[model samples]
Target: MDSNDFAKFLSRISSTPLRVLDTSIPNSKYIYLDLSYDNSNLEKIDASSSESLSRFVNSHIKLHHALVAFGGYNEIRSIYQRSNHFNINQETERNVHLGIDLWCGTNTPIYAPIDARVHSFKNNKNHGDYGPTIILKHVIKDVLFYTLYGHLSMDSILNLKVGQFFKKGDCIARLGDSDVNGDYPPHLHFQIIKDIESYTGDYPGVCSKNDLDFYLKNCPDPNLILKLA
Candidate 1:
């Protein structure tokens, strides 16, 4: 987790796996597909206007099936504190993404990707926030680290124990519905952390442009494992 080593490590793992699929799929079939789609009824996203990014998935036929499959994570820029923060019962403004979003569709099975123990779990109910979530601890090559899986169904944590172990690629949870999942769409926000820093089920998945340097250090690109960077 040496912030300096992030570039070296992530670059190496980015192209390693090369693909994602259903971890539970024994055949590893249907691993690759064009992910663009539009007007999908999976959630509340209505692609009434073709200009919307939401329609990018539907309007463009070339990217028909490239939804987030089970392989690894896709990178996206995010910000912390850039969005207005307020006290509970108060309102806040816009936010930016900080973690790599695995675009596998809703109810897609999410696996551990590594053998790790459940560090903590929580159901963050904020709009646009991670719905049911679980954070697991891992140590690769003696470097202690953890991964946070957000936007999961509540059942994912049903028998999950704080110290229980999940083998890599073991199905641990399913993508959840909009009611439980944050408002936008269903996807998993997977993050890698060198340290949890006393944070529970929640971590600043979004950071401001100013604080990005600090967050980029704490939360390196998860493609270090997915190798899809």
Candidate 2:
């Protein structure tokens, strides 16, 4: 199905709002992050380290949590530079992030938005990788889709099993510390996929400019359900 059709399908299924984070506190804010090449702020500090990133977020923004819009074509030079994982060759680099990232404290609760079955789970133990990742499959009105929760804590996937069921608003996992969560600050890399396409446990959350069309079509804007930023 096309993106418009997929979005409609998602809206139908998501009648109730999904609480990916704790909603108890007041004054909780969502700050939009700009990692695009033209943003001059990126040049001031290093984004690769958790400490530097945290300071950057806390210093500039008063919000408790930071929110990033999905499908943002970013120029995350520090993180993607000199890495074979992101830059395959001189011509192309996977700098455009495809997922909506929610930056918050470690051990924060993460919930399943709808009833879903665990499709796969794994610990991607690589630098700049999704430390503990889980993919859940959901079906609504004869349409199937998947949700990916990356950068999770090790404890979150300790007893997880394939085909495990989770009800809507279920606390399936918690945010991970920087050491285990791809060496980045604590955050949840949430994404929606119409088709997994042979990928299990992990998928490319970023793509090069040349392949932007394919990835954009494959991964719809996660904000259709998030509705935050």
Predictions: Cα RMSD each:
6.4, 2.7
Tens digits of per-residue lDDT for model 1, 1-229: 4687854664564344522236433323223323222213323433322124234433332353333432222222222122233112223322335566655456878877767888999888876578799998876667677788888887877777888787776778888866687653456778877778989888877654455567778887665556552
TM-score of 1: 0.71
lDDT of 1: 0.60
lDDT score of residue 88 within candidate 2: 63
Model 2, 25-96: lDDT tens per residue? 322356666656667886787866678877775554554343422224233434666357676676786787
TM-score of each: 0.71, 0.89
Per-model C-alpha lDDT, please? Answer: 0.60, 0.77
Which regions in candidate 1 have their CA more than 4 angstroms from the true location? 6-15, 18-65, 69-94
Ten contiguous residues minimizing lDDT sum, candidate 1: 74-83
